[model samples]
Target: MATSRGGSNLHWRNSNPATDSIRGGSAQRGIRGGRGSRGGRGGRGGGNASTPKRDPPPEPDIVAHPLGELLQTIRISDLSLEAIKTSKPTDITDLKYVASYNWMEGDAPTIMIPGKPPAWTPLKQPLRLKEDAGTYFRDPNGAQYPRYPAEPAVQAILNSNPTFPTSEIDIFACGSTMGNLLRFVRASSKAFRFSVEVVGKTVFFVRKENSPKEVIENIHGFGHSFPEAYTTWEEDTKGSSSHQRIVQYNFGGLVCVMRFECDGYLRDGTNQVDQKLSSSATSDENDNIIVQALKNTSVSHVFSTTDESLSIKTGGNEVHQQSIFDLKTRSGKYKRDIDMSDFLPVLWLKQIPNFIIAYHDGAGLFRDIRVQDIRNDLRVWGQEHKDDIQQLAVLLNKITKIATEDTRGLLEVYCAGHDLEVRRQHGDGVHSLPHSLRAEWEGMSDEAEESDDSLGATNGHGRSNFSYGDEDENDSSDEDKDFTACSADTCGYCGTCSY
Candidate 1:
């Protein structure tokens, strides 16, 4: 007989379900084992049937590269001046990695390249660098940089100097007004020499340095004095057209003026000067005579005034007067009336020679004269007015200083933006000519030299080159001879020309 098994242990076969069920039933009926025995076997089988677990595979080791780790450890603060100065190995090549670190130093650190000295170094005792207060900087090659990095220095110097007084009169009140005022003052002081001539009603101002003969030849009438004469019935009916005629004279060989008239309409439509029949004909004849006079006299100055006058009425009658006269009357009856109408036309004249004092009444004397002139006049009146001139000069100096400072600052900013190297030259001051003019002169000299060189190369053996030094020497000798020939006590030349 075979051993008996419980129904729980029976296994079904895939091929005949009916046959398996019948076999399972028979096996169950034949089994003699109790529930407790089955239970005990099931527990023992469960304990031994469990699958064993294995440990997880070891994780891959994580190792960082030395260079990468070093880079990661670097910080901007580590690139300080002290760190740079005391860097290990001293060799720049070896410490290139250290230099790679971001730097957070004030201004850009002077990078130390191989074989190059740094601009700045860490002081043994840390200290702030002070800025230079000079207008110029000396470079290694002795070159000059103007209004560059040293603008602050230039400004400091200007500030330290005496300031101009601007309160009494604004030198820059009008375009080119300051320059004009300076010119007038210099002329008045005899610093600039000129000649003035009066011919009839016209006055002429000519520079002493210029050839008077040339000016006389060039003088000619221009623009119509009264354009309305062409169309106005009054002028046509009177058979006279108002016009200006410029004449040249032989005496002194300068320009001459014929007749200067100060006549216009009054508010009530009356002429300033009465036009009597005899006076009118005489005036016409005089105009023609002036044209003829140019043949005999050399006029050096011309005067005319275009400024309008305010109408004045006294005792129910309109009084026609000149603006200059009106101003004088208003100032005081004691004040002399200045006839500046003749002086006002000078401003319009072209080709002004050097040292000439031309007056233009278009720009009235009261409006154009410098404060210094007024002060001078006051002094002439009395000695108590000396302080006024000094005060005015102070104001002018202050304004000039401020302008110079602003100009310097602007130049510095421009140079910095362009990353240009700045250099300084010695002895730059107001007494010297402007830098732009000096530069132009230098450029012209260089061009002249170049042209001479090219000519020399082309000529080779054809011609002898003139010596500039010899020419300059000859000119100086001539000037000396002229000076010795003239007697200081009794000069044949005019006072202006004698100088």
Candidate 2:
């Protein structure tokens, strides 16, 4: 039922109309009340009636009261806009790829496996969109592990041969939580909710997407269908569902870990594997730095499969960061000039360099398709939005500080009309990891602190044996190197029996 759009003026950059000091809640018009029963004075029946009003008394300069003792509210109007805008992010020293994984096509929470993202295999011939309905994932992560959306990433990292260093990380978040905070700092329109929990020094920020079945209304475009027709899941990841990658970076003195879902990657062609998405994605050596890093960490753990409810497998090739891309399909009938401003922030947040916008006629025929490398646009956006980013850093610092100080670990952040409030979680809050993992993580944190202090470390700063690669060739024993070990810790995918 989709249409083809024509004559696309796909400008790589669409200037943002908004200035700084932005906040939500405006353009909310009140409804006109019905005519009064008296039908007198300034009622609807009182035609052309005007009443002379007396001047009201001036209000006092009172402080905005807190919603609750524990509840902390954040509103743009309450803060100094100039100060936040001029604020420069300081002490951001390190940034690196933390860990990555894909939500495999299964369930444990019904064969929850780490399935790498599918490769970009484009088709030469045009095909019917609606007619051929292929399998796809709406919310693969949420659906697979309904308990926690971030569980797979944690599982994947801990399950790898070289376990994660819980002490080094100050924050663990996905694109949703990070985006929500950024949106709040940038004074975006839509309201968002997320959960925050303090696990040792690492504060976990998990996204609360309506529910396990996150409803996406009015998805009538080719966003889903177009990709199905154009890209093909390669041989290794043929049965896999969705891909997600995690990156670690330092911003405003905090070592933050962020996870993001990849749409697909661009190859030289279907046959040529491991090619950069664009010229911008590569240098003289062919592979970009991110690609090499991805290659170093990329490894598979063969897992057992179950029936229809869940299908777990391994042997999927990892797509490098530079080759990854995000795609959007819009109706090309009106020859609309799609803006890049709205899309650039998301791409930058995800570290996605390539963007594809496809236009189709009303009846499912796309011709005006263009692939754009928006690295330059992202750089410009980052420069322009430095204030917003700085505000984000400040806000993050504030949240982390509050969460760390609080005795009760679980907290919820809710923003509606005007105020953004952080309160003690009402119900049983979602746990980031299993009890075993939490214990191990907290134990290691203590160990790292003790180790730092004993070694005359300044302000007790230290890292606990962190490695990017899943399998460390140099450090592995004969059993580990020979793949003879199969514990729940070694292979997170296995529930029991090496599955």
Highest-lDDT candidate:
2
Q: Which regions in candidate 1 have their CA more than 4 angstroms from the true location?
A: 1-271, 275-298, 301-499
TM match of model 1 to true structure: 0.16
Model 2 reaches what TM-score against the true structure?
0.66
Flag regions of model 2 displaced more than 4 Å: 1-70, 78-95, 107-114, 131-139, 161-163, 268-314, 454-499
Query: Could you give candidate 2's per-residue lDDT for residues 1-499 as a string of tens digits?
Result: 1222233322222212110011111110111011001000010010011211212211211122112234688776544363355444632344455555554432333222344554444432233344212222224465455444566677666655244677888888887778767777778735666678776568888765443333333234445555544454555554344567777777766888888777676664334432223344333233233223222321221122322223233455545566667776666566664566656766667667677666666556665555666667777888888777676777777788777666556676767646677876553344555555555666666566776655443221122322112223322323553333644233322122222
**Shift in Å, residue 329, candidate 2:** 0.7
Query: Which 10-residue span in candidate 1 carries the lowest summed lDDT?
Result: 37-46
Provide the RMSD of all predictions against the true structure, rounded to 1 decimal.
51.7, 18.4
Alpha-carbon shift of residue 428 in model 2 (angstroms) = 4.5
TM-scores for every predicted model: 0.16, 0.66
